[model samples]
Structures are given as C-alpha cells and as structure tokens.
Target: MILKTKITLALALMVSPVMSSFATTFTKEFERSDGIHKVKIDIYEESNADTKNSKITASEYVKDKKVWSLVDYVNKCPLDINMALIKDSFEIKKINGSFDAVLFSYTIGCVGGLDPVTVKYFAYENGMKHSLRGEERMVTPDGVIDDNVKPVPDANLKNNVLLFKYMTSNWNKASTVILE
Candidate 1:
C-alpha cells in the first residue's frame, strides 16, 4: 500500500502542471463626452476561464443604456506563456468632426512591443452602429506584421476621407475611401 501510494503521488505531480487551469477577469470603465452625446465605455477582460481563451470586450452605454459592444480575442498560449490585453494601450478617440465616428485600439499578447495591436473605427449613423475599418499591426525582429488593409497616409477627418498608402507594402500606389 505504501509503494502504490508513492506511485500515485508521483503520477499526480507529473500531471499537475498540464491539468492546471488559471482564470482571471478584469474590468475598466470610462466616460467620453462629445458635445451633447455622452458615452460610457466599459472594457471587460477575461482570461481562459472555462472557454480556454482570453478575450476583451468593449461595451458602450448611452444614457446608462447599452448601445454597442466590440470584442477581440487575445487567444491562449502554452503553459509557460500567458496571453492578455495590454490595458494601457486601450484607447478611444473621436476621429471625425461629428460625434458619429470613433476609433479604439487595444494590444494583445504577452510581449509588450512585440504583440499585435488592433485598431477599429466605428461610426454611428441613422441610429445604428457600423464598423468602418478594423486592422492589426505588429513589428517584430523579422518584419512588420499587419493586415492587408493599406496604411492611411493621413486621417483626413476634416473632409471624412482617408488616403491609403500601399507602396510601402509593394502594392498599389494609393487609394482613397470616404470614411463617413
């Protein structure tokens, strides 16, 4: 009985790390006011609870009512590596002259500067929320990691037009899109 107990304990110790599950949740709240529009933003982050993945969700509330929400998966890593959102990189900005268009960004993964950062542009028009642009970029030792979307030369919010520069990626010279 003593030998059998020792063997069982050894096996348990060997499998403990592989069977371990760590879970965590984090939340952040802020308010943004542009003119007469008041928006309350809450960012919720959850790490590998029972879902086996980390995710970040941004909920927008107007007049204490939930209006819109966005989510990004931070993904899961090996036992030695953990993935989570970089709270410091999360930001929301008014991109247009009107209060309709807004931009938000968040960085995911363990490495600070080496992780992929995502930027999303949203517009609320005619009492509805619409996604205008969403892209991710990261610079690593090898090269630049980015979505296929062309880089904007200038965020021309004055006229609500964006000029995309693609030459840097050896694509088209330029292209224009109406952000509004």
Candidate 2:
C-alpha cells in the first residue's frame, strides 16, 4: 500500500505542470462618467481547469456607425485588437447603479461553439445585452452587415467603454492605469 501511494503521488506531480497551460484570462478596462470600469474574459481547455491563458481580445463594438446588439470577438494573439468575429446573440447581465435598468453584458458568438463568452456593462435601462435593436444593411469587421436589428446607442462605443473603464481608472489612480 505504501509503494502504491507513492507511485500515485509521483504520477500526479508529473502531470500537474502539463495541465495548467490550457486556461486563459483576458481583461479590458474603460471609463464612464469619469470613472473606470472592467471587463474580464476567461478561456480554458475544456478538459483541464489548470490550463489558463490571458490575452487582449478585440471586437467591433459598432458597425456602420451603429451599435450592434450582438457581441463579437476574433481570437488573435494576446496583443492584437483587430479581427472579424461574427455574432448570433449576446448574453446580457445587469449589475447595479443608474445604468442597472438597461445596462447588461454578453459576447457576440461562440468560439466556433467550443468556447462560450459573455460581456456585461451598465446602461440601456433594460439590462438587455442580447436584444437586436434593429436591422439594416451595414458593414462590420466580419463583412457587409445586413439590417442588423440593434440599438441606437444614446452614446458611443467609447461611452460604452465606461462600462468598465471606471475601475481601471480608479486602480490606475491607485496603482497602474494612470501611474505612467
């Protein structure tokens, strides 16, 4: 029994390092009302929890100068920020504050249906993150868009950045985003 236990432990240790490389975490921050907000995205190997990776991901928040009710993201490297990511729906989640009623979160599409992503923010007054506001022929990183039913943002995508910029800015004042 003692020998068997030692063997099992050895085997576990040997495989541990190999397991942690499959997960990833990505965070983006912006400002709203002069405050900072934060957005976090996590991607991992379906078979392993220890596998983690974090990189900067990008999506066109606006198309044809209009707001897309859907969320989109294209997996580039950890630094590139331009890519065409298609979207079928966006998962919206409401938090707190004045924007609570309409503010929500969601991601545009799936990682080819393998990786699921969700983005949340504040505003809208309905906490709706996936509702298509309207549809029209337009253009996006993915290509020429059709009547994509979405919302006419009372603000800009940069305004939407306020969704998480507040936190980043606050932290920066305390530590990094503003330190430099």
- In model 1, how large is the Cα lDDT of residue 77? 42
Q: Relative to the unseen true structure, what is the C-alpha lDDT of residue 50 in candidate 2, on a scale of 0 to 100? A: 34
Global lDDT of each model?
Answer: 0.40, 0.33
Kindly list the per-residue Cα lDDT of model 1 for residues 73-141, writing each as its tens digit.
544543223233333323343334344433333334443343344443333332344432334544456
lDDT of 1 at 63: 63
TM per prediction: 0.41, 0.25
Per-candidate clash tally = 0, 47
Query: Per-prediction RMSD in angstroms?
Result: 9.5, 14.7
lDDT of 2 by residue, 1-180 (tens): 999999999999887754333444444444445344444444432223332233323221212232223333333223222121123112233334544322222223223322222222323322233222212233345555333233333343334455434322322122111111
Q: Once superposed on the true structure, which residue ranges of model 1 sit more than 4 Å away at CA?
A: 1-10, 17-52, 74-102, 107-127, 132-180
